[model samples]
Structure formats: C-alpha cells, structure tokens
Target chain A: MSGTLNEARLMALYHNPSAASELDRAIAQDPAAAALVAEWRRQDAALGALYGPVGQEPVPARLRDIILQAETPANLPRSPWQIAAAAGILITFGASLGFGGSVLVARSGASPSLVADALRAHETYVVEVRHPVEVAGSDAQHLQAWLNKRVGMSFTPPILTDYGYNLLGGRIVPVDQGAAALLMYENAEGARITLYIAAEPGQGETAFRFDQEDGVQSVWWIDGGLGCAVTGDLPREALRAIGTEAYDQILPAET
Target chain B: MAVLDEIEAAIPALRRYAIALLRDRDAADDLVQDALERAVRRRADLRGEGKVLSWLFAILLNLVRDRHRHLTRSAHLVPIEAAADQGLPPAQDGSLALTEVHAAMGRLPLDQRAVLLLVALEGRSLAEAARALGVTEGTAASRLGRARAALRVATGRDRQTGTGGES
Candidate 1:
C-alpha cells in the first residue's frame, strides 16, 4: 500500500497500527510516496537482516581474558580519615572482646571505615603502572596453591559461577602475624571482587562485620581461625550480600 | 549466571560494531578489549545485575567516540574504503546487498549515524536510541528522518521507476 509523507511519518511513530489505514489511503492517492516508504521499510528490514543477529556471536576469548585480567590488587591503603578512625578504635579499647565488638558496630555505622580497605585497594593498585596485582589470575592453579599456603588455611576458591564472577586466581602477602591471601574473581563486565583471607590478629576478638568507605564496600568475619574480608566497588548492600554468600559457602565448608 | 552469559554473548556484536566503526580489525578488537576491561573493572559501578548488555554498549559507545576522535584528528581524513579489505572475508552474498546501506550510513552526519545505528541496526526504539545517544526524543526523531531521507537519495531510489520529479 502507498504511504504518504505525513502518513508514513505517522506510521513511523506508531510502528504498525492505525497508520496502516492512513498508509493505504495515501498509497491509493500517490504511488511515489508509497514507493519511497516501501523502500524505507525494505532498507530497514535489510539492515536488520544484515546486522540483527549479532547478539548470538560468542564472546571473544581474548576480550574475556582482558576483562578477567583487570582485577586490581587488594592493597589499597586506608585514607587519612580512615586511618584516624581506625587508630581511635585501636587505641581506645586495644582489642578487648567488648571493645572489638563495639568497634565493629561503630565502624559499620560510620560507613567510611567499612570499605576503607577495599576502596584503598582499588585506588592504589588499579592505577599501578607495572604492578597492579602481585599475582595474575592467569595462574589459577599456582595462585590458589600459593594463597592457600600463605594464609595457613586450606580453602577452595569460592565458586562464583552463579554470581557471574569467576575465580581468576589468588596471591599472598604478609599480614599481622603470618601472611594474607588475596583471591580475585572477575565478572564479564570487568568488575573484580577480591577476597582477602588471612589469620586474624591473635589479640583481636572475632567479629562479623560490614563497612563502606569511599564507595567501596567490604564485609569481614572471623571463622574457624581464619579471618576473611570481601571487597568490591559495588554498593554496600551488594558487597555485603556477596560477602555473606562467600562466608556461607566457604566458612561452613571449611569448619 | 544468565546475566554473565548474556554479556559474554554480546561481545561478538560489540566486536563487530567496533570493527565497522574503526575499520581496523586490530583496533576494533582493542576497542572491544578496552570496553570489556573497563566493564569488568567497573561492574560494581553498575548498581544492579541484568542490565549488562546496555551497560556494555554504553561503555563501548564511549570508547569508540573517544578513539574515533583521537584517531581521526591524528590521521588525515580519507574517504572510507569502498569495500572490506582483502584480508577480511568477503561480505557474504546477503550483506553484499547491505553494503550500499553501510556506505550510505558512513556518509551521514555522526549524529544521524548514531541514531540510525541504534534504531536500524541495534533495534532500539526511538526513545531508547535517544537515551543511548544522550539526545532528546525530538532530536533523535529528526536525525532518524534525515538519515532515512539521505539513504533514499544516495541509493538512486528517491523516486519510483515511473515517477516524474523529486518530491
């Protein structure tokens, strides 16, 4: 059917409705307008046919690797404000059980201290020129073995397949008494979440905690002699949920 | 689970778009690479899950614009090549027909090109196109109209075989 300039324009607006009637009428009056609109429809359909099936293409392996590689090290230093607050808490109660519980509660309330470690990690290491991460996720087996050895805890990498974050790998570094383990997971969208597992300071009491600082969120808990912290740039609630999920999956299995 | 799979699924389309826009296979791959890298790194920047495709497109679009401008300014302007390079596979018989459409698309203004790509190629509604391009609905509609008209004129199909004069 011949569609008119005005009718076709209207048809474009309502992509196949009452405008069909208008299009038919316009075509009866003017064939050229009808041809023009028909061509547009044809071209639109043709282009759609040419490029429309793109969603089915497999995600490139190289791009996937690059995204998986974007995991920054979890060594961001605390901000001055966070440092001050942490110092205040450390000095005020000195790791007494009552003081530690109160401190965790107070830090959770503050929001700035909860994710202090995570944000610090993101800011510091994400921009590193040569050494963003000590261990690349590419060495999954080696990193895992090393990390497990470092923390003195035997833990399987959290199965993040359900969360759209895959375990890239892990690394080790010195902590309070011995060493800490940093396991990294990556989502397809290039977001990296780090799981920091270490031995808690013997002097400190066990606590379940969540915190946010400078937009990063972290949740930590001490279970079965190993203290674990999960950190990411996600919202406090999301980080907490992931943290809780990790805690539930890993902590119980180990204990 | 599904969200990651879907995003993983979108990478090919994203790669194709990048290649089309940059016309260099390596550069196109790099664009997709940077886009994916940023996306994974900034996944938490996305508030919720399941909007991964949209978010990836947004990231890809930004990266393409930046790289396009930088490369265009750095290198002297030249007419886009008439055909895909010899090394790349020949346009399949079907896409050969759409080559004219791609050429017409290349000739249109950038603003119009963005709208048409979002609408015709990406299957986005005009409103969605507008949102993606960060333009108003009216502007998107106007650009789309102009794009359609330009394509009609360039293809020598502005008038029917029997029609007398231009409208």
Candidate 2:
C-alpha cells in the first residue's frame, strides 16, 4: 500500500464512504498503515470510554438556578419596557394614595396568597417533560369542559397567538383557596407561560395586577369572582401583554 | 414552554461537553449557566425546536470561545494542564492508560479537540458535528484526522506499540 493512499484512507476513516474504501486498498498494500489505523481506532475508543460518563454525572443544581436568578445590575436590561409601565403605575397609585402606596398596590390588593400558589404551580409544571398536562391541546374542547366542571365554571383557554403563544394544554391543581385550572401556552421557542384560574368564592372583579419575584413574573386578577394568573420568566412587558391578552379572551362568567 | 422539557433534558449532555471544554467542574457549571441564561433570554428567537441542542451548543461554544479569546488577550493560554491534572473519573482509577488518554486529549489544539470531541467522544455524526462547530464536513474530517494523529503521538501508542497491547 502506498503511503499516500494510506494517509487518504486514514483520513477517510473519519469521513464518508468514498474515503473509507481507500483505506481498504491502502491496508492491503501497507502493513504499517493497517497498524496505524488500528492504533488510531483504539485511541478513539479509549478517549470515548474515558469521557462518556461525564454525561451521566448529576448536573449541579447551580447550573439551573442561574437561569432563575434575576441577573445582577450588570446583567439587568438597562432600559426594559417594564420601566415605563412601572412609572405609569407609580404615577397612578402614589399620587393621592401616598398614605400606603405599597399596600394599595394592585398586586397586594388582589388575592396575594392565590397569586403565590399560581406561581408555584407554574414553576413546578413548566419544567415537566412526560406529563405537563393531563389532556393535551389536541383535545382542547374536552380539556376546557373538564376543567370548567372541576372548577365549577368555564375556564376559558386564552387565545395568545397574537402574542406568539399557542395553547399547549391545561390541568387542575389544588391551590390554597381551591382547585385551580392550569392552562399552559408555548411560544415557538418552547418558552412556556402557565395560566392558573379558579373560582373565587368571595373575591370580586379586580384590575390587572403584576407580581415579580426571583425573575418569575405572574400577573394576577379577579374577574366576575374568578381568579386568573399568568406566570412565566419573560420580559416584564411581554408578561403584561400575555396577562392582558388572556384577560381579554377569558370565557365570560355565569351571572 | 412546549419544548422546555426537551431543552432541559439536554442539560446533562451540555454539562458534560462543558466539563470537557473547561475541565474544572465549577467553570463548566458556570459556562452551562451562561449558556442556559442566554438561551432562555433569547427563547423567542428559537423557532426550530428540533435544532435546540445544536442551538444551545452553538451558544455554549460561542461563550467558550469568547472567554478563551478574553483569556488569551490577557496573555494567558488556555489552561490545558489543568485538564491534564484532573485525569479520568474515579471509575477509571488505577487505569493509567485511560488517564493518559484523557491527558492526551487535553493537549490537543482547541480546533482539533472540538472536532474530535464532537465526532469521536460525543458521537456526533460528521454533518452534525460540522453543524455544531460551524465548519464544513471536510474541515471537520481533516481536523479529526489531525487530532487522532496528535493523540497517537501524545500517548505514544503508534502503529507498532498500540497493537492490541493496552490492557
């Protein structure tokens, strides 16, 4: 086997078929080339065997936690859209309501406890793989009816396509207040926003309320005695937009 | 997220690749974190869910390259020796041959190392490896050849010596 052909064959071993055949001819002609190819394969195998287990090693939780952290001042968006919205909200509430602006804030005014429960469920289920929802979006009608019955009213699966999210599915999860209907929507990127809704026995119609904690944002509201919350780790404005979209599209309540 | 679980599922693999690239466990985790943060931040741009892994790898590789360039700019070459000292995992304890194999890999030039790791160690096909590395199949193939050849020298297990002899 000519040394040139052997080199080509050696290179071909890592490439497509045409180059692989050249190794066959080279091996027949040159014993050295055959031995070299054999040794190279052994090295390749050794390296793979040595490093393969790295994949099996438990991933450090810190890696995932980093995603949830509201990045430091250096990493925070310098001019987020939420800044403007926050200013607007600030002007409205802090004017005559300066006595207890913090307490009078929309987020704390609505069912704060229920909003926390909804955020928990969103975080818990958003990362789920095999069973995020009991009934997928394929059976949207059944899912709607089932959830509506479970929660004692129609839980309108919000239309979010205009905001780049399509309904993935929904489920029912127990909340501190009562059983809540959880509907998950996904955008093209697999980023999901979960909406949790349940009948509020004593709560009445309320205004949009935004809550931010640990980089997860959830907008909670009460509409006609129904509590609704949309949660995700999205830009503030985006989450507000989703919350508003879902608010406008929610199924009407029974008088 | 529709494919959020799927992306999350690939974390272990990404961590492994990061470990191979960065050598130190803490550094690797940091690199993975940065990659995930960037991916999550830019989630809206990820239209093709099927390419998520490749997309993540591309982002990871970009971060690695940026860090390396920054380090190099500061006059520090990549800490190849750190990986050499880390050696193989505990399971490979007492396996000097495997330790040498791991060290030999660390000694590989970054280009060749990436190509070899993607194709040979990580089991990516040539096309997929090329896609991940942003190179042509021919370039990836050639780099792989050079990497294997370099390993043969670094490990001193060439044609005559490496003849079914490393037990």
Say which candidate scores most in TM-score.
Answer: 2
Superposed by TM-score, candidate 2 places the C-alpha of residue A12 at a distance from the truth, in angstroms, of 4.4
**Residue A169 displacement in candidate 1 (angstroms):** 15
lDDT of 2 by residue, A49-123 (tens): 666677887555445344323222322323665356435544543363444434434547657667766766776
DockQ of 2: 0.31
What TM-score would chain A of each candidate receive against the reference chain A?
0.49, 0.56
Instruction: Give the per-residue lDDT of model 2 (tens digit) for B1-167.
Output: 55555567778888877777655678778888888888877877888757888888888888877785443243224455554454545433222277666666666667677777776666666677777878887787888877877777766655454344434
TM-score between candidate 1 and the true structure: 0.46
Top-lDDT candidate index? 2
TM-score of each: 0.46, 0.49
Clashing pairs in 2: A1-A29, A1-A30, A192-B1
